[model samples]
Target: MGRLKVRLILAFLSLILLPIGVTGSLLQLQSSELEEKERSYRDSMNELESTIKRELTQTSVSDLELNALVNQYAAEINIKDAEGETVFTSYKDPEAAPHNEAIVDSSTLFHVQAEDGRILFVELSSQLPFTDTILRSILISVGSGLIALILLIIGWTWYISRTILSPLKEIYAATEEVKEGNLDYPIQYRRKDEIGKFIRGFNTMRTHLKQSQEKEEQFKEDRKQLIANISHDLRTPLSSIKGYVEGLQDGVAQTDEMQEKYFRVIRQKTDQLDHLIEDLFQFSKLDLRQLPLDQQFVDSRVFFQSLLDDAVEDGKSKNVCIDVPRQIPSVTLSLDPVRITQVMNNLTENAVRYGADSIVISTRIDHDESNFTISVKDNGEGMEKEELTKIFSRFYRAEKSRSRESGGTGLGLAIVKSIIEQHGGSLWADSELNYGSTITFTLPFLKKELV
Candidate 1:
């Protein structure tokens, strides 16, 4: 049996057996007392009978003397002659009165031959110590108490079943549902007891499990898409390179200019392939948390100056003007310089690839002085607001055709977001369709050493 069932059974037994044990003890005590009183009454009656017998033997006992003896003993006396006629009784009218059977059965009797040659029979009454009336009252009291006890046990059993056992059964059924992979099932108990808390906790756990399963399924779908994108991207460049090599072997490019153009196209395709592979490698490291950050405190102004110089140099080829704030914040920033440089490079390259003519880099410190914010705004054909949220997701390209033409692997912003977050920072973008876009990020400020 279950522990609770066993406990309830033991409790019921205690309720029943305890009262019975006590009642038995009380009844035994009352019985002993009753026996003692009966024995004493019998002894007194025997003494009275013996005295009367002796007195009759010594001298002829007068009726008045017998009456006096009966009065002294507080008993009833009956005296009969030898022929059983004309007996003297303590009752005033012996023929009109009948003796009680219980009193007669408990009475003492003796015979004595009188001096007149007649046998005298005398009987003395004995008072019973325990009566039928008292016995009946005791039985009624014990019976009522037992009935009340039974009612109490019944109510207790019902309470246990409703509050404890019922909920436990529901929990068991819920577990069975969970074992069958049904996470949507929930317990419907509403009380605020421990059992209710447990039920609520179970429901919460099921909800989390459901969410996790959904995320896992989504991740699987994203992985499939990633594989498809990688295959398509890899095949395009390899096919171009293979076509160019075959053309050279077949002498399809007869002139020097045509062969030079074919070789240049092949090198460009190879470069695209190299860039795609490098992005894949970087994204894989970031996703797996294998990319380590060499975080250090660096002066913000010096870092931005170097970053802007590199961006300006790279933007010159695309005719993109790289603009920066004349005054950079003089705070010390905590970041990985190499990773932050990669972030800037990716952002500026995205701007140049997306028809940006001018790229502006701005910096500001938060009012609380806890962190620094930087924004890279560009005059490019911006994206819709809906695309902003998904730009940081791997393999998510807002403009697939434009991305292919620009040789974009779609992991640039994703990598940048990862690097920023790993440095205890956040990144977001604000863009308006047909307008310009601004990509903003934050980095924590290095704490000042106490003097």
Candidate 2:
């Protein structure tokens, strides 16, 4: 299974099995050595019996003297005559049997038939030295095995703790760094295991958190720029209104026609102020996702034709000839027509203000089955590539100057982008510095598959 599972399994198995195996091995060694000692002791007893029988039959030695010879074997001697009379005993207590003492395991009984037709009984008993030696060997072997097992347990514990603790320590350190807001630091573990996967997930989380923080900062910056632009833009129109009002009060317009003309200019400036305020409010609503779409089904051909006809009239009236596509593909679209119209109006207004003598509205079907692309192209002073990237950003102007020629409150393109994106479409601009600019956007069709 996993590395952690395997390590734990092995550790527990060793804990259960190692001591049992060591104990069994030492017990078997002790038993084998004891058996060998028993065999040697039995052989020595047989040899001593043969020597005693031969000495009593051939040498005719008395039991007391024979007992003196038994001392050489470190054995106790007991003798009895055929008449059942006690003859001699090497034991300190004449009535005591050697087998009744601690040397019972070493006691051996022998019967001898002498040539004089007499029967004799002899008992020999001694503590075997090999028994004590074997006992000591067993104790030492058991103690050594227990010590070896303890060391093995200690070593195993160290290995298991290191294997588990090291990774845990690394993870803990990484989390502490994240808590301190250092998301840029990365862990360098690359094992293909659970811990590795966990580390990778943590790294991914850190990256996303860092990105979210950056977006928040950028949002704050955009809000600040919006406030600054609004103040500057409102100052211009309010200044004009103040100047015109003061001029009228001071009788600068003496004639009725002049007075009427001054009032008309004031009205025009007031209208401009109203439109600026409305656009700013709309952009804010769109940015905050407060504006919801009221989508309608409209024939693409009719929609484009009507929109183009209005643009052509406005463009011609202003001495700028705008071109409309003669043919538009017959496709039904699901869209918010009011918002799309506002986007086109903003783009067309930009074209006219920026010295475009000719403008064209065109369409292209996207490779996808659901959506079609529309572009507003103008032969205006196009922007640099770097400027193109920031054109759709709120309060960003490539010209870097607040002027009437640059059009509305600098939120027009940004609003257009938000509107198109809200409708599940995309918007972008293509421009060459000296050639021209095209603002393109996608509109989805009414097909159910498109949704």
Candidate 3:
């Protein structure tokens, strides 16, 4: 902008100055020529006057001869005396009356002659040479101005493109790269203007982003190390306890009472170990994509009902219900029934112990046919809104005090979520304090829409 402003000012001034310069130069030259012509004319006029006076002194000369002498002097002086009429006369050819008298422009000389030799007509035209030169000067001024304007435009455009536009383009490209997550870019454009300040701000932002990424990476490494250490320590003692409990139950240690006691301890230790390992494994899987999924044609109603029955028939003494729809659509999918069954079992058991004794397993087939949803509802004791949010997180138990005593592996719900996600489904929980809780999961349709 600064350079453009300068060019604009120069252009306007040139519109006036250029013509004046050329015209003045030509005028100076013409004025010098006129002065020399005037000087020569004056010298010739004085010498002619002296010769005419000398001719007049010869009284014996005839009238024709006197006229002839005067004419000879007039031809030398390049001047003539007339009645001031619009006619030209030359002294060299007076009898012939050739038209042409004095020299034109500044080269012309005139001297008055009278009967008393005091006053006579004396006139000369000085307009022709000066006027011609002025016209030529005006033409040259216009041509020269046009040439200079063309050259100025070309030079200014080149300068603006190289020093301004190109740098702005580079700044734009660097800003795009920063937007795309490359936080290290040279954003310094030394413009000494607002653009320079903008570049400095961008560089500062990049530095902040770089520092943030470095800290996040370091935190991730520390977390990984801590999880590995805790997992190792847990697995080791669990294996020992399991082995000893099996030995006693098999009669290697003799008494039934001892066996029952050992088995109880074994159960608690195994639950703890399993919870830790599952939490780590599920978290690791969740961080990656393209996890393996094994699915098959399945009637979810029957599939979920069996899990309820199995859990009820098992050692746990809880009333579990299969409250599915009368008719549930069957879907063919790339799924693993075994893994899915494990997920259902985990949710049912969680409901039975943590939320309620009586559980209802049901299915919802919506009108859109976009997906099939399965829910397990419990009425024992519901949880808070905050608890439901963290319920699917590993090792997160709403009733911390009660949960630690139940011998539950806190990773059950988390494991269920991971399995469902791998099958292209999602899971969520809805609960109200003391009103009961319901956990629902949706599996997308095999053909992109489920019945």
Clashes of each: 0, 0, 8
Clashing pairs in 3: 88-100, 294-335, 294-336, 295-334, 295-335, 295-336, 355-381, 356-380
Order by TM-score, highest first? 2, 1, 3
Candidate 3 lDDT tens digits, 1-451: 6644665576667656765665566556656776676577566655655554443343222231433533543343222345544322323444533243333343345454434443223333221223444455556656665666666567756766765677689778987987897777786566655556666777787788888887687558636654654555465656769688678767776777877777787776787667656655655564454335666876555665565557556625444554544455555445687888778777766776775766666776554655678887888689888777778865566775566555453556767888888777899989888888889998866654343
Candidate 2: count the clashes.
0
Q: What's the lDDT for candidate 2?
A: 0.77
TM-score to true structure, per model: 0.64, 0.66, 0.49
Number of the top TM-score candidate = 2
Query: Best by lDDT, which number?
Result: 1
Task: List, residue by residue over 125-233, the lDDT tens digit for candidate 2.
Answer: 7556554556676787678668777887898778766666777787789899889988787777776677778888988998999899888998899889878877877
Q: Please give, for residues 1-451, the per-residue lDDT of candidate 1 as tens digits.
A: 5555566787788678866865666566667766786778677778888887777777765534776566555577888887886467774334333344233346677788766667988777745534663585468557755875787688778878887889999999989998898988888988776777888999999899989988888778868977987888888889989999999999999999999999999999989998899898997797688988998888988898888887888788778899886688777887899999999999988887888899899988785757788999998999998899999988888788888766788889999999999989999999987788999999888657211
Q: Pick the winner on lDDT between candidates 2 and 3.
A: 2
TM-score of 1: 0.64
Query: How well does candidate 1 score on lDDT at residue 136?
Result: 52
